[model samples]
Target: MADSAESAAVPIISTSTSTSIANVAASPAEDEAIPVQRKSSSPVTDPGTSPGQAAPINSAHEQSEQEDSDDDSALGAGSILSETTSLADEITQYRYEHNRRYHAYKDGEYWGPNDDKQNNQLDIAHHLYLLTLEGRLHLAPIGDNPQNVLDVGTGTGIWAIDFADQYPSAQVIGFDLSPIQPMWVAPNVRFEINDACDPDWGYKKNSFDFIHVRAMYGSVADWPAFYRQALAHLAPGGWFQQIEMSVVPTSDDGTVTEGSIFDMWGKISLEAGDKFGKDLRIHEQIKGYLDDAGFEEVVEKVYKWPIGPWDEDIHMKQIGLWNQLHWEEGIEGWSLALLTRVLGWSYTEVQAYLGKMRTGIRDRKVHAYHIINVVYGRKPIPS
Candidate 1:
């Protein structure tokens, strides 16, 4: 990414009007002014808005929040080597259990043996931190400088760490049920463990330049409320980017045999979502929510990701291979935890299901699919 794009942006901002576009119910519009990096005339909901596939919060415990925030803030601007070392220590000393009790929310976010390999291959934080520079995607709807960037349910603190590294001047925070971040790193990035829906976040009003949420598996109940909170924190011209996958099994050619193993996963997982009240329907209504939340200049980017092994392209094949490795060593840690802990499925059932899922990810049959929606909207800075 270009350094300019990596750093803070310099652009005129605008104030958002009532851009609500859906019948979806939302709190009274918390229309706020947000800065915009792109030029005028390009509206968020002008013509494009998809339904579902969207992904939020309220909460507070000022004492712990401040303490965690302070300690996290104290770590700043260091070599990646040193940071990695500290991260190792945190993971080793993790106090939270990733068993059948807690989902992948806090202190026990996966830091398994496969993490190092996965980071080398995908570099999750780099993907997220550099997204703002990808203006063509038009995903960063919030104005250039998203002052308060929150990574909900941050895992490994990877996304938050990189974002802070990229924007050393911005105040970035990562929250999870576990406190697994390094003790020494960039001052701008902080990690905390708390229920995101609590009422004591103690965030300044209209202050966050951006709020980025990812991997919305079972962590949020009311997405509209989540977006509403994002809207509330967004300064005019700010942006909220929610990136996620459907976890819904899909066919590359739109032809998945029900007899296929991937299809079995789709049935079982969708059933799981249904039983848990997880709103699998949200994937279809993402665009509507941003509009209702009064965020304009919305953009969505969809990429087809293969689960196990898919590579008609040479590059993707290499990534596919690496991901397969992650799937081998890391899949158990991630998949089983969510299945048994949150989905309430038995360990044996989840393991049996994963055997098929892992095969799909390996053989590219689970035909498992994902939709990465990079939804962004500026809070609207004054024109």
Candidate 2:
């Protein structure tokens, strides 16, 4: 992993609007922009009427409304692009191997991509998480207005920002390896660069009211040790929740063939993660880890996340669409380092394999879904 101090101090670099396409939410009439490097566009200049000419009231009102709408639309896209640029700036000084641009941080450290594609995928996955959780930020029983919260592995810092917005009384800190969080965040929400696996988290003992971690599968080298550290830092009665997606896809109708590309992807991903001392399938063992770490009132909620718009339920179908898009957009970024660097496959071979896997992911007939596991536990109060 990158040095946490250096990552935090890096300046935010400027990026063009072209990179903002993946961040924007559009109406039916709007067009989606493709993700590509390009020069920043000039600001939209106002076409003011001539000095002597008075604009019509109706046209003026319409223009004002249009401008407001434009600003609103641009805010989300701007934040997303800004966060990506900041993260890129932080890690650009690091050594990257191969034409694939994979970071060579600690040997056998995080193998995930930190570029635009991965950032966009993080945003999309956040959307899907909201949808799956029925618009709830988390399933933890964090209680109302918890004073202090920490989001471990807070990619893109979207959850931390939203949580801060939801509970203004609480201070939310998003900790991550890369400085991928936006510069413009809520007063209560801030991003820090740190490794969760670091035994000495540098926080006061029993300080945090709540701690949240999500989509961190295959990131940490030690699961039990990490939970123990969380337990140590959490206040008595504080809550710790972990959310992870099972990398292995399952099918309800048995349409996903046993030896298909989906299975192959999961197998290869698991092997790669194991090689790095992090297992992508670690979600399966979270409950055990929490139990072993002496957490109390442990609870687990599992949700099936369909890969395509194949679900019979309307809500599930919409979720599947988002998941499908996220999977498709992320396949390349997710596979490149794992396949080429760790798994000893050529870049071309990895791309070819991902292409096949993506086809399976998009096939609605497959009815494929991954299990999303959410487990939370509380620190017992001292007797």
Candidate 2 lDDT, 1-383, residue by residue in tens: 01112121111221111111133222111123234221111222232422432221122234565669866675676786998688656554554555434433343467777666788888888777767665677778888878888899887787887787778678777877776677765456667667778877766678789999998888888888899899998999999999888888877567777898787777878888888678898777888999999999988776767787677665556666777877887888777777776778987787788779877976767878788887889999999
- lDDT of residue 174 for candidate 2: 83
- Residue 215 error for model 1, in Å? 0.9
lDDT of 1 by residue, 178-291 (tens): 554565555556676655554444565676777777665545667777778778877777777776656566665544567777676656666655655555556556778999
TM-scores, one per candidate: 0.63, 0.76
Question: What is the number of backbone collisions in each predicted candidate, taken in the order shown?
Answer: 66, 0
Which residue window of length 10 is worst by lDDT in model 1?
A: 1-10
Give the residue spans of candidate 1 off by over 4 A: 1-138, 141-146, 326-345, 364-368
**Candidate 1 CA-lDDT value:** 0.52
